[model samples]
Target: MAGSDIKQSLRKLDFPLCARDALYQIEKLCTRPGKQMELQIDLMSEFVFGEIERRRKRNVPAAIQELQLIEVQSDFFQSPGGIPAVRNALFLSLYPAGSPRYKILGNLVSLAITIHNKAVLNAAGIWMQQLGSTSQESVGLARHILNDYFVLTSKSVDRLQQLPILTPHFTANLLTAIGEVYKDKNPPTEVLRLIGEWINDNPSLLLTSLMDNPALPTGGIPMTPITPIAGLFRWCILSPVRTAAEGSTQNEDEQKLYSKIQHLLMDSVLRLKSSGSNKHAISAQHLAATTRALTLVLQSFSNIEPTSRDLAMERLAQAVSSAMSANCIYGNKQELLLLLQSLSYQHFLIEWTLQTYSTKAV
Candidate 1:
């Protein structure tokens, strides 16, 4: 329907729901073919933005998210004796973080960024952090926020830190995604700084990553989400960090930040190799991640650091060699040999060890 026609139909309906149903109908319209939507997109977008902004008159980051704060849809959360606000009802009922209607928020966030709207940018971290939001919701918002942050100059780097505390699963995925996004090139100081901060905040973050879930009431094992650790390794070791971010003020020593990140990655590797208990043991899938990270770490160190190169090599070799023993119990010898053989091209050591280990296992 035409914009005017849609409005006329809405006018014919009852009070609060009339406004809501109008927005809902627009939400449905958005999912149709893009070419057809060109006519109505602007009209619908303007209506949603204008109506919400006018009703809330939000002037600050906190105020911008006032609508989201009302998690439930009810009269108690609305204005007294005024036209009942539809935002709470719309957000809670009509649209969830996963539904097609959720795209509206993504659109609004993009437009806000294009115009340099600082308050809305900060508000994203807050509203997206609402507890009980599943990994799907957090990842959706985080991808948009991080992707946008990539285009920002270093002067606005502080905005990266303002992202509220995310769940561990979300954080893990974010770290891995960062690696892929920058896979083809060197990461700048701004990106490195963000990675370092995340590593510092999460203790034993990588070491415990691949373990299983806790036992259930029926006595099942306690578990953590099982995901490929290769991405984490790539995020940490495959890429080099620049001495400084492009166009940065050169105020802080970014190379030092890189060192901190390397140290954290190395420590996590050590934890994985040294801890012999069931809690630290890896399953068959984790071997791929471990091999890739180990290969990249040794390779990356040869290029990135000089002073600790020999010592890191020594400690890592002994620890990893011990982890690879038949009695190690993390993964069986057959799996390890096969995994190493597949990764033989990663390093000369892998090729040589795979040949020798294959002989022994056979």
Candidate 2:
């Protein structure tokens, strides 16, 4: 069929059917090898973009479904030049939040991450930034995307680094997402290595940015949100001291790497504890998140050597205790107590295990 005929048909039909047909045609065109079909692909993309815009407000749900199909099912977005236009179309259609359409948008975001195409990532990043501005729901979804999909490897980092605009807020959110992933029991070691390298490269800048938010409305006192910092420490503590092989000592290089990460984590925890002195700056939510993160960090020490684990537990305990004492004005006392109780129980188990092992050895 001719391009004009297809465009005419797209206008006549509803969004869902139009999108399906448009995607099918685009896919068929894309499958043909070489640039011979480039013009056809561009034309189909424009047609899809235009049709979606035309019907966006009137039938947003349908438009979103179409976008999802395009993102997941077609390679139209595989073209670098076409990415921005398609991305803008999706972003613009994502208005009037809290609609069922958001679920589809969330899936599209996931697909973009999975695709890992540079152009798509840029688009997804921009869309995330925009979503973050809208509401808590959108922000929550954004964090979910980060936690579930964003891989903290060199390539992913490079994509984020090369984004045309990596605003401070976006960077903070990105770090927070990484933190959530680190909260997992067995977050990838590559993620740890990447973050450790990043911390080492610019030790103060990222942490300072994370910790030094402007004063909240009530006072000029600076209150840093503890979630991201907590995630980092949780990840650090969870980092393996040795490989899976039992009784195998780490080589010199591995030992040095472990020591460096341990030091970085200790320094970060100390910084967080010191920040607690600004009690007026901290809030109930901040304190709760901080406590929760610290609890997780403390729990992660179960797999480490006796000396290193003891030192980590001590520093974490001191940090948590100091923060709680200074910021007693905020946080749920009961919740904090429970977390501490859990940590204490875990610590006891670890100690008991060590003592039992020592006695047996003797």
Candidate 3:
């Protein structure tokens, strides 16, 4: 009869009931023995939030302080085994995993924040480790929960980038999600390796996409060193040198062939600068542009070059130091300065020994 009466009273009570009465009821339920702890917990949370809203409406400091205190206490309260009776009851009745009030659902934002926190990364890592296990049913459940959490959170990519264990999963997931978001009709790669393959297979397409901007004005081949051209040139120069050292080619014949290719590039640069074939001239121009840009960048290579024995080294050092202080490396600023000082002094002396053998014409 009392239970029926209580239910009737609860139904009759207006939502957002009198704050004083609500607070009193909530507090009493929280303190009383044999009370349904879940009801108390949920009611308390709601009441506290209500009080916070009320205070915020009135600009009440007391209400703000109370809300902050509640948040702080609740952080610790939500830990494992704080109030299992209340937690279990709430988890089942209101806050079930998918339920709006379930602890997992209720604190989705908080869980994401915890997942990203460096101090708590290990804890999250444990959760991920447990999730990745094949034998555990909880693993699949936890993985789904985390995947949802990551998808919803704004900091998902940043968090995943920071977490080494999640890097592979996040990269794969992000590419798919990005493709969907942009409606990328043809998505690129499942992994970074696959990205390299795509680039290798479709180099001209990659170049065209990058260079197709209206800002580029593709009426004729651009005379100016554009970013796309410069990037390709830099990669071409650096890639072979870095990759083709010892085990790069299949056999000695291939190595010798590549070595001849290297001599050809340098020879072409010199010949282009002197004789000025359109393609080779453009190549030389790019080299000059790059040297001008990177003369100052070479300061980062201070350990590689020493000033003790070489006068050329000392002059180069001074030019680099001046460029560093000025913060300009491009457009012949550092290059001209270095050339006027160190390079102008070097005299070129070339000698070639030619051996000729007379052979009968075939």
The best candidate in terms of TM-score: 2
Q: 2 or 3: which has the higher lDDT?
A: 2
Q: Please, what is the whole-model Cα lDDT of each candidate in the order they appear?
A: 0.43, 0.46, 0.31
| TM-score between model 3 and native | 0.22
Task: Order the candidates by lDDT, highest first.
Answer: 2, 1, 3
Candidate 2's residue-wise lDDT over 1-362, tens digit each?
66667667767765446655665565444444441355454444444443335555454565565665556433544554443443333343333345444555555555555555544444443444344422354455555554444443334544433222333333444555555544444345444555556556644523443444431223223323333444554444433332321334445655455457556644654555556543332233433454465455445545545655454444445434433444423444445444445456546543443333322221
Please provide TM-scores, in order, for all candidate models, with all chains considered together. 0.43, 0.44, 0.22
Candidate 3, 129-172: lDDT as tens digits: 22221213222333344444455653443443333333222222
Q: Cα RMSD (Å) per model?
A: 11.5, 13.5, 22.6
- Order of models, best TM-score first: 2, 1, 3
Give the range of the ten consecutive residues with the poorest summed lDDT in model 3: 349-358
Model 2 TM-score? 0.44
- Report the alpha-carbon TM-score of model 1 versus the true structure: 0.43
